[model samples]
Target: MSGFEVAGVVIGALPLVITALSAYKQGKEVLASLRKFRGLLDGLIHQLQTQKTAFYLDILEHLREAMVPEILQYGDPTEEKCVGILLDAKTGTQMHDYLGPLHEPFLEIFGYYEKYLKEITSQLDYIVRLKDAPKDDLPNIIRASKIQNASLVFKGRLKFTIDRKTLDALVKDLGTERYSLGKLIKRVKTKREWEANEPTSSSTTLTLAFARVRESATLLHKDSLEVPTITVTETCDQLIHATARVQVKSICDDAQHSRNQGRVLALELMSDALGLSEAKHKPHQSYNISTTLADFLRDTAQDEDARMSPLNQTLLALNVVSSVLQLRPTVWCNIPWNSMSIRFPIRLEDDLRIPVCAPYVELAADANLLQSHTCSPKFDHDSCQDDHARDGHSTVGDITSQVHGGLGNKEPTRRHGNIHGPDACCHLLVGVEHEQIIASPCQGD
Candidate 1:
């Protein structure tokens, strides 16, 4: 090789070597930072187990022993004064005259305390739900609990980031409010008044109140407000699961008792159809599924309401027929194969009969709305009339008849155009090619 050429190559290699060394150093620094961050997380998990856990337990203990019993004796948790607590309602404008300027502060304190008490109860309930936890549900519950905690952490972090005064102010407000409640409790006049103030709906009130308590706790804890890393999370979860198994039997028993009493573990809105008429002047219309319908669903072992519990997709369809009918109110003619209304119909009556005849038509789901599921759409090219003729599937004619409830072979004549009348009733009939809708206006006696 030429001497000049070898010299050029050596000179070029110097910058390359330097760059590589710099990249290596940068990578090492990143790894070291990650390790340090991990150590912080480990300490956090330990703190959650030792100090924070005990602190939360202590908070609950004070609330349970001190506040809860007092509120129970008072009846209305919102009541600001002893007289109001005894009365079980608002103290009227008379309160404004007496307490005057202090009334607003009293009311403010009452509201904040109520919210704080609620958070405590919610945190307690969440803990209670997990304490007698099963191995199978522990992982899922932990994940959910983490989500709840994140909300708290965000509030605490906000407080910490802003100023020291926010925390101090909150503490002062809480203390003053608690003292007010204590004084109000002592002002009860008669035994009869106390009895009258008893909580009419204790269970619902308790559940809602506890939810607020957990919310408050998350707002208060600043130092431990950061989200735990996977290592710390898993460690904390392990600790909880280890301690939780002790009361599993009792928790299971409590759960079972709650179930038998028709306890609602949760409630979910099945579809937007539930509140579809909100803008319509006829708000809270007669179209809702009532308690009578719920009774009927239980009485008849029909699997029409697929989302109804136990047989159960936790979310129940509010109304099956109206929902389907509402979606295609304009298309009143062609029964669209791809409409979601067929699957998620608002359930009304227990008389729902699922005809296996028609194939479920799936439309393309847009990503912006929800992630699209792979759909194997069974497309029936036939008109609505022909769609129902298949074996095992109820014919359109039969479905229409069944919907009529044997009122008469005399069906209401199909009417179209803006329906404005005294009493409006609409029935939709799906045929192979089109859905024939019969609308009739009624004259009430």
Candidate 2:
């Protein structure tokens, strides 16, 4: 009896041991796979970082040489053949036609800027504010005072300058029409011409003076395109303090608003910086920020209206710089005590205002960091089951794309819907033509 009972126990224990061993092997495999995935991800992230850093360095490299000189040269009155073109009130269409060849030099100057910007895309970190600071302590329980951060404390709207003389000249020239009385009268019937010619000598005035003048000046043109600029301050201290609770939800929320404002500003800045409004392409769609920022530059910079004033040219260069610098999101890491902080060390500037669009795109983060953080998966909450496939119900994703054929003489554009977030971005393109700034409070969807 004792031997049989011992043998039965041994048989049962063998299966239990095998089951335990299988479980351990499975667990080890899972851990190994996770490590492999993380390693791969780290490599990819490093590659991305390297590529982006190189691009940023390239942009910075062009600073001393490419930016100011090009802008100054483009707007130089001496270089512009049409700058002092006389405001001829007669035959304006003819005058503009004559001045067309003169604007070529200015166009050639901005072409390089457009070309550079087109080469880089989606390599900015918007989360890090322009003015971020490193932490006092590190390698311990990481504190909130060590990460990248940004905030849009409203620096009121920027005032853009208008070229008044040019606008006025254009209006005056287009207003007047030259017509000879003899030719006009000749077009009239013989009877009317005879009646008009008869009152020459009998104490009646024979000649009538008719001078051509502009019918109206009010609608001729806008005085200036308002390129509104705002100051955005990114404190390293603030970013460090804010990154304590950095999560996907928060990043996503910020991204929604920031991108919206960014698009608007990009368009405004491009329009203003490029002198795009006055471009012969007249009220173009794609060149504005609403459609594509980089594409606009590449496409419209070649248009007839792509002639840029020096200020506008500066803005375009500035926009490219800002866009690239702003592409990277501020590095945020979660900390204890419900706090978040920035992970990277950064240099700070005093009350620095970098021009940018609002919420860039959300970033793909580390899984370990993600697992350790408090974030709710973006899934349907009402239908809850342990397995994603097991749940029969479908969750509709948030849709942002809609395609349509645009009006004639217009570029195809993307019309973004209203978004909800704590920080909303507002950009105005028509006024300045380049991406301009505005920081708004976050509102719920």
Candidate 3:
């Protein structure tokens, strides 16, 4: 049978089982054996009624929100009407059209109950037959049988009798099915709630934004944008925050435009100003950085000719640019972009040191000191330049100081080794290694 027909059969048989149990109860006075089984009959009837209520009412209540008006037109979503509409081949297309994703799960739930109900209905039918049997035959029907004691029939054909063991097994199987059905119902309810709350538009917009950012970072360096995986709760909160910010900004803009046109809109304008002031006054959240690019290169320059290669320097520059591009539009961009802000994560393998040339965006508590300090190459050049000159080579500190100094300069200046601009500083740094290689042979001679 089709799943719809099976569901209908199960629903139809439940009432029959309940009626049969009730009828059998009426025969308790005639057969003394029947009086002993009264509690079993009552329990089975109660369980059948509960199952019927679950199918007819509880499941329908959860599904009602997703159901279409066309389906409701058939009648209230009682078990018989629900199954009748599904059973109709004419309404088959409507089922999928109206139910969408819920159609399959709904059918699967019905299919599960249908499997357990077949056995239940058969056992109840046999009990009903015993109610009509002559008094002598009824005694034989209630006889102690070894089959009931030999083993348990959890799902298969049940041997019916007035014996406690057989009836207990039947009740146990019913309880198992009830537990399974309850779990399925809970699952369906959870799925429905999730679908209702899913932020489709906000998720799509955030995904697109992240994809663009990743693409831009990839162009600079493949591993430049290795962001940690955020938890689902965190991601959802971020999306909600972003969406609310956009909406609030849009509303404030509209209100300002209206005010400019001589219409007095006060509440939204006041809210917008308050939000900006609150965000501006809030204390910056700080995080510690193990080693910045400037710190790493300065430490390496202390050793003899331990300068980073030109290629690695170029890669580091690209990574810094990528990090700046990603953070520029966010709240984290409050600090200036300088050598101290560009971090390098270190890794060791087999006594070989590998430094990741990516810029870590976490801001340190002493970050304000970096902004307040004057950008002067003199201090570092005095300390490290003598070491480089003694070794017949320039230190990596010279390159870093020059680049960061250029960044700090508000206008192009002739000081700092006559570097015209930040662009010139970058160009000069790129060729520093090549100049060292050429000067190496001449110095040896």
Candidate 4:
């Protein structure tokens, strides 16, 4: 071959060799990565499967114990039956007790209402056939039917007719079967007023209010708005509180049930990487019950970021409340009057910021950087007087003296960085972190 031809061949061969080497190196690296990834994935999958199995077993066992009677009672309506079973758990009993006197009576009232609705539909079955009748006439029929037993009194300007027998039946059911919620409400209010008027030495009114809050929380039949207003601060807050209580209780209950299942689900999940699943093997116990089905499914997935949803957040809140209440039952038994406001933490809407302060807590829409903190030194709104802060801190004394009319609050001024003393009313460590909203103190502070 000529010199030019030989040089061309050499250059072409060099490039082909280089390309082959590069391809070989890349192939080896890719294979190594795949092996590493496969091992990791296998470990993760095994871990998840172990956890998934344990969680189901633990919760299922608990459900089996808690739900037997409820299952039998509402067997035909599976959803209702499951709910009843959940309500029968020890956690459920704890919830009822926390609610105090409100629990049994509220459930009883709800039971009556359900029956009432059923009875209404049964009595009004005539309307389904009388679909051809004047629509206006149907309202009158329903109204007349409802009032025959004097069960309902319509104040609005509306006219309707009802067959006499249906009306009488409706009235009779109201008078005999249903408890008078109106009367119960009136009695509660009356008791409240009497307690308010009584001497401070008697804590009877506070006790009554505590019971009322519990009762309100358990009221299943009330409108959503009413439920929050009764016990929680804002509507959203009430929802959050309710939801949290439920979920946390489930997790705890599930943990407890895991013993019979050989290992707790949460711990089993951790063991997959740790290799606990291989250590113990037991007969697969069959469970007829399902507890926290939503959580069980989600936990087995590969996605690590997939967490308990908003519903789960609610459950967490409820569980936290339950845990706190179980630890401190007396917290709800009495009112802490020293604080400026009382707010129960509940989430009603997304992005709603629920405050831990009292109902009267307010922030003016237009104000400078104003911060409110729960203070120390027993800050009862009614008892505070001016000049209380000036007694010891002489540095700020000049400012006090220069003022023509003194500052409104007598509770000691909390300068920045002041360590809270034991006597501090709010027991709050006031800082930029604790402050929420730029609020102006009300006239009374």
Candidate 5:
């Protein structure tokens, strides 16, 4: 009722009102800050996505550029016949700079590292289990070799992430920046020096093999911090080169068992595909007797039994792969080639295993097919050879006595396929598309 009482009530409410107003202002500021943060986060995501897009695009572009020089740019069809063509290589400097960007949106490097870590760790664990393992321990030796390989990769990829320039140690008390990479770096350098000092010129294939290994390893190198990719790839490259050298040697020296190791499986795969499954299990004796594709071809030409033998398809498959190698050496370096199918321009009602010189195969002028454009896959199609390509550019050229003579054997099995006429020079074509990744289990070799 009095003025004093009304003033007391107003004063009590005043403090509450001021506190509420302060809280509202603070909440608005927090909300505004959050909005700004969200905007920045979105921008970062967009930028990262753009960078990844560019990275993958660059990879595709690089692949395109590599192929275009070999096959795409050739205006003349005859020039595309790369049976004996040795492709020109890109430069080392250009290769070093190929992966323009390091970061990936897909985060493949993380996965890659995870795989490497698991593998190497497992290997190391295995060695540890064999306490005080001898230097000659087979498994230990294998794992150590892998470690050395990883070490090499670490060197090549040194430029990608951590700057080699910044590895210098700034000793606080000494006030000096000493060059460093700790102990392993010295070991790697010493090993490299030792390798460099070794006599290599005496081995004609050494340079070529090492070059192959380096070029192959470059394909796996990328700018990434997550994966230890370089090491695994380097090891793989080295192993492949070593294996190739050994295999080439075996072939040249006529080391029958060694040379026939993987080729036999490949021959069987081709034979099985060519409706000659019986030859898949053909005794190793057969392969020992015939080592090279030319040997098989010669045998097939001389003997009627050879035409029906698995060697017939085996020769064709080897030739095809050889042809492809002439064009793209890197493609088949790892492929076991367990399965392949070929089709001739001459159509059959069913899929026929028509033989053609493989994409990279180089057949001798004298090594004529017993039968031109001949295959055993029930060549039932009535469509003429001319009808092969939708356009006039025939996908396969007909085999004739003019180019490759017919097996000249009239085995009823060969007669099963409908051969319209064997007049055209058979254009042997492979079924595999270019630039395809064959992830199938090709480690058979």
Candidate 6:
């Protein structure tokens, strides 16, 4: 069979397996031995459903993009009717014509998974049959007069016949295959992004670059803001095509009246931060910013002149506190609150003296790890400890000591004295006291 045929077969088989497991689970009576497999069955069902959905939505979307002519010949690939027609067994010949050109690529991706899919389906089919078999049709030993209890007999028969180890191995293999498929999708996405930005025969104009950034920023805020507007100063171009200095103005009523209200903060796109110039040459290579908040703080600590003025320090502290208060409850707080994740934008000629730009939180590859870390019982104290440890300090002191020690300050300057107390708890601490203003800690127990 062709690779396209094989993919259809595997995807079609998934729903059958899920339905069998779900039906068995809903059966009026379940043997004690079989009950142990409930959790595994449920997990397998969920995994299979997720895999099927990914195949339909993510994998097919990429495939459709790659084979636009073939897909477009039929109808709109994004529409459910078109997707259904492609996956329908009745249209196998039509799909083969459409997918024939991409056969080798599909085979390379899905060929090895064929055996796994077959074995899983076969095993599940057998299990379903076993569940439906009557006592009279069972083997002599299981139905023997010596075994009085039917449940016990069924349990014994299952223990002897079912290989739990094999089942577990199958599930693990399925998970590995799913992960591999996800990586493949990610590669396709990266390729698409690169292709989208590949310089045409014509030189990239500032207007085109601005339009692209505006489109992206609009999509980013489409769900949140009713009318998202991005304002970029034409002259604020350091890396013209690579970076655009844009302001994220607030349309919300409360945000407009907040501190640093109507501020035109400098923006840095992740693509630029990851080095777009180098990315063009080495597409697959992962790049991160060399300078983090830790590096910045260490350099600032050593150079007293580079440190912010008392008022700016107070403002910096206030911004950190405000961001935490505003964003903590939202998905924005799903990040590791360490110094390394915090980053400042590349400074411009007209940038604020105190680094008025909002600090960017660079996400790690494994976002779940950061989320779990943030949700930990001792997250508050532990986050402080992480900052302290990075600065070569062994113990976590009060917010003031943590901040001052991180900055290599022997004593808190009198001008920044008022920044202490419960208000000073934050991931980023800068000391230069303003007497009238009391700053709150960004994170506290």
- Ten contiguous residues minimizing lDDT sum, candidate 3: 436-445
lDDT of 5 by residue, 109-135 (tens): 323322322332232222221235542
Q: Per-model C-alpha lDDT, please?
A: 0.30, 0.26, 0.47, 0.33, 0.30, 0.44
Return the top candidate by lDDT. 3
True-structure Cα RMSD, model 5: 33.8
Which digits, one per residue and each the tens of the lDDT, describe model 1 over residues 1-445?
2221221222222222223223433444556634434333233223223322332233233233333334345433321222122232222333334333444544553344334333322322212123345322322332334354443321111010112343334344443434343343234223325545765555455455556544433333332243232111111333322222222223334344545655522211222111112232311212232223333344435645443443222112322322222334231223442323243213344774332211222333223221121112211123222323433334323433322222222233321111211011111221111111111101111
lDDT at 352, model 1: 49
RMSD of each: 36.5, 48.2, 22.7, 40.6, 33.8, 30.2
Candidate 3 local lDDT, 1-445, one digit each (tens):
5544555556655665565556656644536534566466567667778778766665354335436344567546566566555455655554445456656766776666555555544454333223334322212222211126423211222233346566656666666653344455566568757877886765665556567656765554433333223221211333433333334344445455654565433231132122222222222222223577778878767765667665545555555765565445232245665677667766565665666554565553333432333232322223223323444433233433433343344253423343222222222333332222111111110
Cα TM-score per model: 0.14, 0.16, 0.34, 0.16, 0.15, 0.31
User: Could you give candidate 2's per-residue lDDT for residues 313-358 as a string of tens digits?
Assistant: 5555443433332323332322221101111111233643222322
Top-TM-score structure, candidate number: 3
* Candidate 4 per-residue C-alpha lDDT over 1-445 given as tens digits, one digit per residue, 9 for 90 to 100: 3221221222222222223223433444556534434333223223323333332333233334334444344424432233334434454553344334544553565455334333433322223212244322322333343344443332221111234455445444544423443443344446546756876732554455556545534442233233222121112233333343333334444544565666624322221111133344444433333223233334424445645554544444443332232222121123232122222333234654322211211223321232233333222322212233544322222222212122222234532122222111111212222222211111111
* True lDDT of residue 156, candidate 5: 13
Candidate 1 has its poorest 10 consecutive residues by lDDT at 153-162
Order of the predicted models by lDDT, top scorer first: 3, 6, 4, 5, 1, 2
Worst 10 residues of 2 by lDDT: 398-407
Candidate 5 segments whose C-alpha is farther than 4 A from its true place? 1-39, 65-107, 110-297, 300-445
User: What local lDDT score does residue 2 receive in model 2, on the 0 to 100 scale?
Assistant: 25
Question: lDDT score of model 1?
Answer: 0.30
Model 6 spans with C-alpha error above 4 angstroms: 31-38, 67-109, 126-162, 177-180, 192-445
TM-score of 2: 0.16
